[model samples]
Target chain A: MEHLPSEQSAAVRRIVAQHKERPGPLVEVLHAIQASFGYVPEGAVPVVAEELNLSRAEVHGVVTFYHYFRHTRPGAHTVSLCQAESCQSMGAEKLAEHARRRLGIDFHQTTADGRFSLEPIYCLGNCACSPAALIDGELHGRLTPEGFDELVAAKAKPAT
Target chain B: MTTTVYVPGDAGALSVGAGEVAAAISAEAKRRGVALDLVRNGSRGAYWLEPFVEVQTARERVAYGPVRAKDVPSLFAADFLKGGTHPLSLGLTDSIPWLRSQQRLTFERVGVIDPRSVADYVKHGGYRGLERALQLSGADIVQAVTASGLRGRGGAAFPTGIKWKTVLDQSAPQKYVTCNADEGDSGTFADRMLMEGDPLSLIEGMTIAGIAVGATQGYIYLRAEYPHAHAALKAAIAAAYQARYLGADVAGSGRRFDLEVRLGAGAYICGEETSMLESLEGKRGEVRVRPPLPAIKGLFGRPTIVNNVVTLTSVPWILAHGAEAYANYGMGKSRGTLPIQLAGNIRRGGLVERAFGLTLRELLYDIGGGTATGRPIRAVQIGGPLGAYVPPAHFDTALDYEALAAVGAMLGHGGLVVFDDTVDMARMARYAMEFCAIESCGKCTPCRIGSTRGVEVIDRILAGVDGERNVQLLEELCETMVQGSLCGLGGMAPFPVQSALKHFREDFRARV
Candidate 1:
């Protein structure tokens, strides 16, 4: 099963066992498999359908309902930065421009070297410290062009 | 230990270099041999009091007005720390009407506690709801939520209890609670504030949801926009797991609920429930036609209850205070408090959580103190981009969804963006179409190609493409997009366009 990758292959069996019992067992199973591998690979759709006793169309429909699921591998580091009014008020748009120019990537694209990936986050709750950005789940506040360079450099250095 | 911070917590504070102000506090304290303990707490929500540094002595935290780092030395010599009364002192920090008057429940612990400290969270009444939830049967927990009347705060005011009940009735062995933290509206920052200020409330709410619905897992569908909220959540989650509030066991209750935060790309459409599920599963964010609502079918085709950040965050308060305590506060059918975001050219821009019956006059005039420009306020757009444009004539309308809808507007997330006379309504109208066009997922034709053509039509109208004919064309396109679109991006995009055209017809005429 380790070689089987994610628990997605068991989705059909899992759903079938629980489908008659409840209406939304599908969302649960999908979340489980996705949590394990970071993304839900396609090979498990039929497994989900067979288990839930729902048509493939029905199962696919559920997977397509929300935007949280991922079918591909995300880069090593995901950088989600604020683009809301409060952040924009503090020149987040310009900071985003600097980020795009420096990282050589747009809002959602990963870099060629796979060193970092950028994601546009709406509000990081760090409005008190506006123009906030997160690198690999670590929050950085009061970001400027100079601050951005030092932080990105720190994130990219060898762990050892 | 002994330092002063005049944080306005208003967007204006950050705008006018409060960041440098914060840095200056650190450097100045080190140089002066004074101790500085700076906390980036939530906005006291007072805009006029911005860059307002407060000095904490033994007795009280004294208020200092709009002090620049350039004036720190003079402030020190003036014995401002001794509270000897400087020219800039605004008296007491908590005495300000904006800070003193709010009956903050959802935002109670925020800006006052360490966001990632589980101990601080528990000390501040964080996981009491989860503990209460574990003691009750799932049905009983659902009853508590139903009685609270907590509705989705991400635009739509759908009752959260009904959504949770649908998933609860589903007998699926697997279930999921998805928190939609993708707050993309232009003038809103409440979600980010809650996350950074008091993250544990959200975690506790999700945990309670998991126990109430028998779901073993939860996911926070955070937008790519908030890097700070994401980090705070991640650190808080790790702390929860270590403290046994999360992970396999869930604090010795043996309920076995685990949570993971999945980050979104820059897609705004994903904020929609179904589209959020698709993107969470790692696919392009496209709207799904609902027969299987996320309550019946969501996330990975399992029974999932998708809720907004406020919807989830408010759960702990409801469970702790009981349904009636919350239900008694609001005016009409709109039960409980709503977080109102004031932004743009407003005199006082910040977040205010209040009971649901405040009027636009009260919001803009009394609380917001009108527009900052000192110019005449032309229009106010409530509920973010999807909400209607309220001309000054309509400012007296109440804030309830039904009432707002009656006035051709909706109380969508209660984001009020103030625009002065200088704002070009025609340009704003055109930009609305452009935003929809760029952000549309292209799954359906009305939202996809229609938005692109919308840009062209608006541009043509601006360029004087047959006066009457162009206006007719614009109206026709808006109707099609509204009636035929698959999701909100297309369905609600016409609101701003139609509103601008209806109220400010002269602007369009001038462009033509």
Candidate 2:
């Protein structure tokens, strides 16, 4: 088992404590931990399991089950392209291919520079303007290959 | 006098650059020294015309849209703030032909008012249903819902009233009302729009459910994908709390109803009611076997009322107006209006809330204006990924529940994803199985294993490897999944594949 730093362990305990009173607080606690940390740290799983009085396997099973919860550190920005039927009708498959070629990475892969991570989201409820992509939680619809490139380029620039 | 300009804060509108357009309008107004009162309202469901801007004139709100940030300068020059003419102008928002044709019951105030304002919600006849529900006894409230002919809008088509009646009849000290806001259906956005546009309606509806079922607590099991909706719901909930429409003393009725939103972690299976309950309990989103329905033992083993966002949201309208009024709108078994979503390859794709008798021909061509790519529309997939695909022959099928079922289709959540001739039916079939394989919870065998096998069989057929035998094997596998799976996820996943095979047989021919 990986050992979490004392500070990280304390943060996990605090996150668990904040939501412990609520019924079925494990998911909420995990969300809080992931929000504070980029991903659910493996080392913190045992701590959460201890605080919630659940087994480590149970905690680990939950963390792995949900697609939203990441296991590794994410890049500076995450790009989620809609891959469902509506988006597919609007050429999302082609757009996905273009995204992969542009990012030089497939879905669920991060760029070597750690600038962007690409994910295939089932739907974002923005189907009216299909072939939608969420760039750092901001949605862009009717996205052409060029639009995708521009979005990536904008994110790539360093902050002033 | 300051001119009031309406800009949609709806997620659909924002996706098409409404946020940037609003900023441009603000900046342009300041530059021209024009006094402007910009209100961020919800989308009118005319997504083709979004970011659909409206200006309040003496007579009505004039519309202009598909507006870009660059068009802001030209709009200002034309004095669009005063309902001035512009190339993008669509005249009066109310009189727009596409929107004017439909019947909007649940979405009455969606694109009209600021979603965050409880006062605006009240002004538009929001809490009247809750007020009515407050006056009635629990059994009376249940009877009213039963009389309304309201079915579950979450694709189950279960009687909303019966579910409530069961929960009402249960003798439990702690019960709950759980709103399934996990709208994971690919082509659907009605739930999202309602949540973002008029969240107070949902909040009010849930409160009514709580009072009706003796459930003081409520939880909206919202999906994590909709960050916009999450923010909107949270803000609206806080406002409801402040106005005393929520907390222990809801609307001074001396009843307790507390509501909060819980985020689901991107599990499509969680959209399933039992799976959702499991996920809410901080576990893997595995399907729970029926016989003990969620209505009997749901959400922490309590006799719970589990309803869809639209179903719960519609409770206010039913309570506000008589049940007969709602019942009179739609056709035989399926009653009342459904918020239909037009998406995919369609030219004028958006939300259309209408009574259930409208045919697909009216939706696809008359309203949607045909395919966006100018190609012939080959097929239309209604009711999410699990729904059957209808070829052009069955385009005349009505949007009613039984009407669709008669033609081997179902109006699951009222989403229509149109596809043009360019679509490869073979690939789509494979994708259906693939989607099922990915989203299926491993608890069930036919769903978990059958889906993967179905995908492989389709792949082989596509690759020209014993195509005939592979197709047969795929059909058998789909049958097994349909008959054997514990829940809808596995059970209905084969509908699209079977429909595709039944309709477009030539697509499955050997590639070589």
Candidate 3:
């Protein structure tokens, strides 16, 4: 087992402590841990399981089951393209292809430069404006290949 | 006198350019020294007019839209703050033909109120239902809901009052009320809109439900994708708690109702009530078999009242108005207005809350203004991933549950996703199986294995490899999956594929 980072361990402990009183609070704990660290660290699972009084297998089972939880550290920004029906109707597939080629990474893979990670999202409830993507947390819709490129470039720029 | 300006903070509007428009309006107003209060209201369901900016006049809120950041200065120059006549100036917000003609009971206050404000929410008839619910007996409240003719708006047309009465009748010491806000349907945003736009109504509805069903604890299982809605809900929930509408001693009736928002981890199956219950319990969102319906045994094995956001939100209106008054709208057994979302390739993609009898043709041509591509509309997928691809030949079908079911289609979640002539039905058919394969919980053999085979068979037919045999095989596989699957995720997944084969078979055949 890997050693848990001090801050991550502390954050996980705080989250677990906060929600441990609520009935079936494992999911809430996981959400908080993920919020603290962009991804749920594998080492923290054992700690959470121990704190929540469940076996490590149970925690691992939940962590792996949901698509939203990431076992590893993600890139600086996660770009999720809507892969549902509405987005498909508005040329989402073509835009997704363009996104992959432009970023030099496939879905669920982070770019080597560590600026972005591409993922497929079912729907962001932005169906009215199709061809949608959620960059980090901000949603962009009616995206073209060119618009996507500009969006990524802008996000990649460091804050002054 | 200070002018009150309205800009939508709705996700759809924000996706376009509402944020920039709001900022520009603020900056221009500050630069020109115009006294004004900018309120970020929800969308009016007319997305074609978004970034729709409205100015509150004595008569009504005047509207302008598809507004850009650059258009702000020009709009001000045109004296838009005073409801001046500009090219984009749409006269009263409610007078818009698309919004005016429809019946909006559940969504009456959606775009009209400041979502985060408790004061604003109350000012617009928010807590009338909860107040009324507090006075009535638990059984009496359930009876009123029953008489209102309300059903589950979550694609499943199960009667809402019946579900509540079951829970109300349950002898369980620990009953719960759960709002299934996990709206993963591709073309549906009514749930999200309601939660974001008029969250207080949903809060009030849930509170009333807790009072009616004798349940103190409530959980809203929301999808992770809707961050904007999440923020709005959190803020509104806190405000609701502060105002004493939620939490212990709700409205000082000595009833304790505590509400929490639980996030679903990107699983479409979680939208399924049983699966949603499972997710809320901090497990994999696997569907639980029904015997003891959710009303009997659910959410920690309690008699839980599991309702969709729309179904629960409709409670406030039903309780506030008399049951007969609420039942006055709509036709046939489906006696209520449905918030039909016109999405996908439609020109005017937005939410349309109307009486449950509008024709598909009226929604498509008259309301939506045809396809966004301006091409001839070929098909429309009502409901989400599991819904059928309806052909134009059946456009005259009335928008009711039974009316749609008669035509081998469903009014699932009331989302009408339009598709232009450019669509290939074969590809769409493949996506149906693929979506099922990706989302199925693997508890059932037919759904777990059959969906994969369905995809492969569709591919073979698409590739023209013994196309005729594969098409027959695909149909057989769809039937098997439909009969053998555990839940709606697998059961209804075949609807799209079968509908495609039935309505658009030419697109299924090999290129010849």
Candidate 4:
């Protein structure tokens, strides 16, 4: 799958229009753009900076300050496992190693088939269950290798 | 008269399936053909015992918790149908040691009252600060805050009273009050908890600030990830407005204050006051330069009062009980309670609010009961990502903001992430820079590009590069990010990255 959906540009334009009135709304604008595009594409930065009356550097700085904003397109399926203290207590380190080995990709990179991307989530507030992962946006808790593989299998399986 | 049984409806409880818990109770009540009084209450901040259920009887509320929907059938069978004690029952909810131990000045009514009911907030000593604040001069209000010694709880422990004094003293016609609720710190969730459990407290806090600082409008820049909190806050704000607790001429006290909730696009950097202001104005969350502090020129280039959720939440307590009562809580110059988020490998993980003097050892062993894994804790990171990695050797150190700083660390946010024996300090140190690289606003060179290259340097060091040179290069890079970066995103990002490397040199050497 392409990192960004084909109509990503249209989404960026729509977000910029919604937040044009407020002063210094560059970050909000970028977030919407990124939401529409998955990552904040290099192409959208100039337009956002221009619309918000901010220098390009200033716009770029805000984007970089936050870890949530991705600059590249995610693979078809993205799995962010929590590594915060609580999640780690639940063996997130071991889980992360399992994920990396299975997917054959480190934190920020995509898999060869473009079927999945795995990343470390600092925390997703599922600490009580521990070893939580967000399969896309859904929270999955008490994860084992089998549970992870089951979820991965669904994402990996071809749709009819 | 409406009979109501309060159950904590905070997001944490909800995350652990509070919806199902609520459904079970309602279903049990209905099946037995019993008239019921159920009220979803805010979090009491006692997270360990969640889905904390309480039943309203003629006299007092009986509590039971750590409940599930599956347990409902058993509860029904046991005739807990009449608010009687069961195996899960913990007697009176207020008497629980964990609940009673907390200095719940801000969280006073959270887990006890109906969140959507405006009357509940008012009845529980809500808006009393705004009522009192309206009668005082702006300077007097600011002075009272200064007297309270309340510091910003969003990690930067700058005195909040001082910030208010500056903004109050500034002569600007247009000012904005911004609540930094974009709580992206991994191990911390106080902001989200406050918003979900007792949003009125935050609204009251912001309104009080508006009255004190001469601002009419406020915005809560909330993180997008907390959809439940956003819904709760939005509903609470609407209730406040309907009851005249917010909007123009609130409570007819002749003081005008209005607030709106703005969803942050999941950017951690926006937690910084300036970046928060930027995001609120509907832009990409970015750091702005100082000298033109938010007090004088912020949010549309107008003077602004930007405060963390905790700092402002304490306002009502300061005003109601007087600043001296609050100021008397803490040990040193850091004179106020801090809600330290205990997380990571810990058996007990939740918020612990106390005066600023508890040692890390006490927090770890006494409060936390050591690691959840039951292994010896090797290292602990106090504060969020940017915090220093503290070894057990510094176990005697106090939890004061200044004390932490004295030992080459700063308490950014009170997120203590513990790591056990199996952890690798070198790998942890490298991940910090990698996190910085991924999240660095790229505003400054040291953080933007430096973080990416910092990872490379760490890799080289790990792959048998000249150890001494690699260490020196890492140190030099940290200094640049510290001096050159615009905000805490880069300024403090090196603390965890560098401190782990500094204190755990053997770990890094072992990798090589």
Q: Top model by TM-score, which number? A: 2
**lDDT by residue for model 1 (B1-512), tens:** 45544443333345444666677767776788887667655455554555667766677767776677687777767877677577787777667676666767888886556566788788888888787788889988898888987788888899888888998999997999999988877777788778777888999999999999989989998875565577778988888889998978887987788888877755678888898888776555778898879898887789998998888999999888888898887777788998887776666666788888888888887887876658778888787666677899998888887788988998887778777787677777877787787778888898888888988887887888776788889899999999999888899989988998899988886351
Error of 4 at B55 (Å): 2.8
What's the DockQ for every one of the candidates?
0.11, 0.88, 0.82, 0.33
DockQ of candidate 4 is: 0.33
lDDT of every model, 2 decimals: 0.76, 0.93, 0.91, 0.78
**Could you give the candidate ranking by lDDT, starting with the highest?**
2, 3, 4, 1
- As for DockQ, the candidate ahead, 2 or 4, is 2
Candidate 2 yields a Cα-based lDDT of 0.93
Please give the distance, in angstroms, between residue B95's alpha carbon in candidate 2 and its true position after superposition. 0.5
lDDT for residue B229 in candidate 2, whole number 0-100: 94
> Cα lDDT for residue B336, model 1?
90
Model 1 spans with C-alpha error above 4 angstroms = A1-160, B1-19, B55-61, B65-67, B78-84, B510-512
lDDT of each residue in B286-379, candidate 3, tens digit only: 8898887989999999999989999999999999997988898899999978999999999988999988899999999999999999999999
Residue B469 deviation, candidate 2, in Å? 0.9
| Per-residue lDDT of model 2, residues A1-160, tens digit only | 7789999999999999999999999899989999999889899999999999999999999999899999888999999999999999999999999999999999998999998999999999989899899989898889999999988889999988
Winning model by DockQ: 2
Q: With candidate 4 superimposed using the best TM-score fit, by how many Å does residue B452's alpha carbon deviate from the native?
A: 2.5
Query: Per-residue lDDT of B158-181 in model 2, one digit per residue for the tens?
Result: 999999999888888799999999
Model 4 score (lDDT): 0.78
Question: lDDT, candidate 2, residue B429?
Answer: 90
Residue-level lDDT tens digits of model 4 in B1-512: 44466666776776565778888878877887776677888766655666677777667777777777788777667656456667788787768776666676766776777878788888989888878888899999999999999889988888898888888888877787999887777677777777877788899999999989899989888876776788888999999999888887788987788898887765667778887777776555657878798888988888898888888898998898889999989888898788778777777777778888888998889888888788999988888787888999988789999888888876766878788988887787787888777666556787788888888888888888887798889889888988988877787878887888778888877351
Worst 10 residues of 4 chain B by lDDT: B1-10
* Predicted structure 1, TM vs. truth: 0.78
lDDT of 4 by residue, A1-160 (tens): 1233436656666788897776555666776776666788876766666666678787776676556778788899988887765576568888999999888899988998888888777666555456778777666656787778888988888998
